[model samples]
Target: MDQPPVPPAPTEQGEPVALSPPLLHAMLEASHCGLVLLDDMARVIYWNPWVVRTSGVALEEARGRRLGEIFPESAGGRLHQAVEESLITGLPAILSPRLNPHPLPLRAYAPDGRGERLFTLMMIKALPVEGGARRTMIQILDISNSVARERQLREQARELRAQAEAIGRLADHDNLTGLANRRLLSELFFKARSRAKRSGRPLAALYLDLDHFKPINDLFGHRIGDLMLVEMAERMKACLRGSDCVARIGGDEFVVLLESLHHEEDAVIGAQKLREAVGAVCRIEGKTLQVGVSIGVALYPRDGEELEMLLRQADAAMYRVKQSGKNGVALTTREEGGWPPFG
Candidate 1:
């Protein structure tokens, strides 16, 4: 290896000495980053030692070659376009890693012993020279670590959003049956009531209680009772419309909301369907367990304008059904003179 030439030492009188061409070339080669100089025609005029080492291209072979011939992948890419723009406008243009990551194929050894290496890229600009010819200079940088960090951050953000959604669902839904809990049901009731008031449609709230529930819990364990409640919730859901809502208020008690009813009779029909669905015989653990449901119905605007009032009236009627018979449905007659005729 030949040593690069150095500037002559100043005379004893302290006179300035112009640096020689060899010394200047040595200085450029000693740069830490990859450097390349291209003529107006985009042919490589000079390349630093860093470029040769990182790109694995020899200085003699890279000289006077076009960048496209050296790196074909960058021929029609943003890096090439940036060079053209700089040459034409006599200004520099930066290629962001976000839009154009890994524009160059040049690679550097990883710090770890692993064989993996990160790719490098460059920022390009036009450099004005003598004789009215413009040159393009490319300053290379390594961005592998930055890209990896950004990807990690995006993945973490996605996981956090998913966890937040799961928490929200847990807060608003019954854990055992996945039905709307009392809090969620209250919110839905208010929304349904607003829609009914605007469209002149009737909404029905049915308060349901499982009859003979204590005997089943005492005969079998609470586990069996819980399974029965879960099955009952599914059956109730099957009997309701898509717009309807079913909620487990507490142990052995559930609420069903029927919205957009054209007639008050529709509510009675819905309550009967629910009663039949719950009253059906369910066989669990090789033992046939027969249970019944007593439901009280309250119509919107007719029974009461508020959710609390309507719920109270429905509860009162449901108790009346339980008093008369375990498996039956009843309509509230608080506001009306007496009980309406049941079809």
Candidate 2:
């Protein structure tokens, strides 16, 4: 019968403890990460059970084989370069996931329970041994879970940004006509007014009210009325230049802002074009419908300096058009006097 193995002698306090070869081998076998040891000749000498499990290679078969023979795919890769550097210069090397994502072909079961093989995200370390024999120890840590979490966080950030943009659009635009809402219009007015003040150029604000619109709503239901409103908004936008803005401030009440005008007559021309475009016949839902507009023009610094003052004067002028028959345009004249009847 064989005798029991002797235990390692205990060291003094704060000193290193000696472990027997069998205990060291046992610890290595139970390690959680991969460990591969190569001799000076670059031949596989020892490897932990973790390496065996991940690489799917038996210990007996890989004991004396070269790394190139064991993992052919890693022969011309970063791992091979790192191993060569460590063996020649006796310097340590680290291969991070960012630089070398899949340096090795080590496999693991996917987390989805499908028993599919997934190439692991590994952080590899090659350390040169400073012992009696020249050797290199390679350590591999699986970082698949961490990498997956980082990817998920990036995707979530993009999704959140998209949602925020959608919410911003909803807040700044009218839902029915997709025109600039009050909030956006106020901001636009501020910018336009500032530019007009600096350049001494005139800015025109045309306040428009659709005539015969209420009759359509009363005769037909609100559905057809809504379609008409949308159609009218499109027509008004088409009649203006890209630099101009048209906003539906209220039901049947729209405001057009024309910037960088060459002359005061430009406002009248724009107003007439809008009047014609809006007064055109619309066949919405097979119903022949026609409407007219009463437009009131207000000039910057001439009518009023502020946006509210200009809008108010323009609205007042529009009301004057409404009182005098209908389907006509009126320009807010100087404080001393006003323009005659015009369309």
Candidate 3:
């Protein structure tokens, strides 16, 4: 298939109806909306200074970036299709109030990933720009102030959704730890197995049970025990990347999914990190309580392709750590002695 011809690189219009980049930049910048100019193929022809200022994506980088590629919410033939309609019809397409779940916020890589919406009053005008027929100017007003207010009302709705989700999750999540219960584990295990098959990637599962947890519960009370779990969760969260999932399978028992592992050594490194984080003393209510975790790791496509086999192997490996002693990471690898002896 022949690729769509690229738009001539944007330049100061010397003659032909005459619109200078400086003047055009000024006009678009002064306007209250984020402005973008695109070719027939949705190739970015001109992304204005205003858009550069707002989105933190520079005009230089914006050139050649497609309407769908620039933003996160542009997945699955969305906003690109909207642009297609405007160009094809040679009519301005306007959305008075934009509606999209996980709407694209103008600024990228902000501290908050689940960012507030950048509700925009979008106006798409099909026009001749550069040298491409597939061309349009998109104007988006940052209606975030209204969006912020709307977010307040939406907070209640979010809370209601959360409450309902919590009820559903309660069936498969540890209430005290807010971690996945055994039931959820089975589902996750199956999914992980499928991921390994589809992606042809190595997957690692770490089964960790905190050492000396019962002593803390006995020494302090169930109340203090609950606080310790919360503290431990925070510590674990600090150690994990966004891709990893940590679930409390049972009391003081946690499971971690180490994704996209390429080698056997990677699993061992993950186990070490878990040891360091959990070994640290947690200070709660002005009292310092120390605990440790014993972790057993099982690799996918190496240990077993099936979920049941891997989980069973991982669990068995975890118990070995407990039986021998505690505070170490064990990987289920036959390279050493196959199933590692307890401890």
Tell me the TM-score of each prediction against the true structure.
0.81, 0.82, 0.50
Candidate 2 C-alpha lDDT tens digits along 6-65:
555656775656676887899999998888888876789998888777677878989988
Q: Write the per-residue lDDT of candidate 3 for residues 24-95, one digit (tens) a residue.
A: 667776875677888877789887676776677787887887756777566444456678888787767666
Preferred candidate (TM-score higher): 2 or 3: 2
The total of clashing pairs for model 2 equals 0
List residue ranges in candidate 2 displaced over 4 A: 1-17, 39-43, 64-75, 110-126, 129-134, 335-343
Give per-residue CA lDDT, model 1, range 1-343, as digits (tens).
Answer: 2246555678778885768788778889888887889888888998888777667778789788888899887788888888888888877878777777777776674444243345455688777565999888999877778888989999999999999999999999999999999999999999999999899999999999999998999999899988888889899999988999999998889999999998999999999999888889998888799799999999887877878888889998888898996689888885531335456
Runs of candidate 3 with Cα error greater than 4 angstroms are: 1-163, 333-343
RMSD of 3: 19.1
Global Cα RMSD, each model: 6.0, 6.2, 19.1
Poorest stretch of ten by lDDT in candidate 2: 116-125
Model 1's alpha-carbon lDDT is 0.85
Give the C-alpha miss distance for residue 9 in model 2, angstroms: 9.0
Q: Which candidate number would show the highest lDDT if scored against the true structure?
A: 1
Ranking by lDDT: 1, 2, 3
Ranking by TM-score: 2, 1, 3
Compared with the true structure, model 2 gives a TM-score of: 0.82
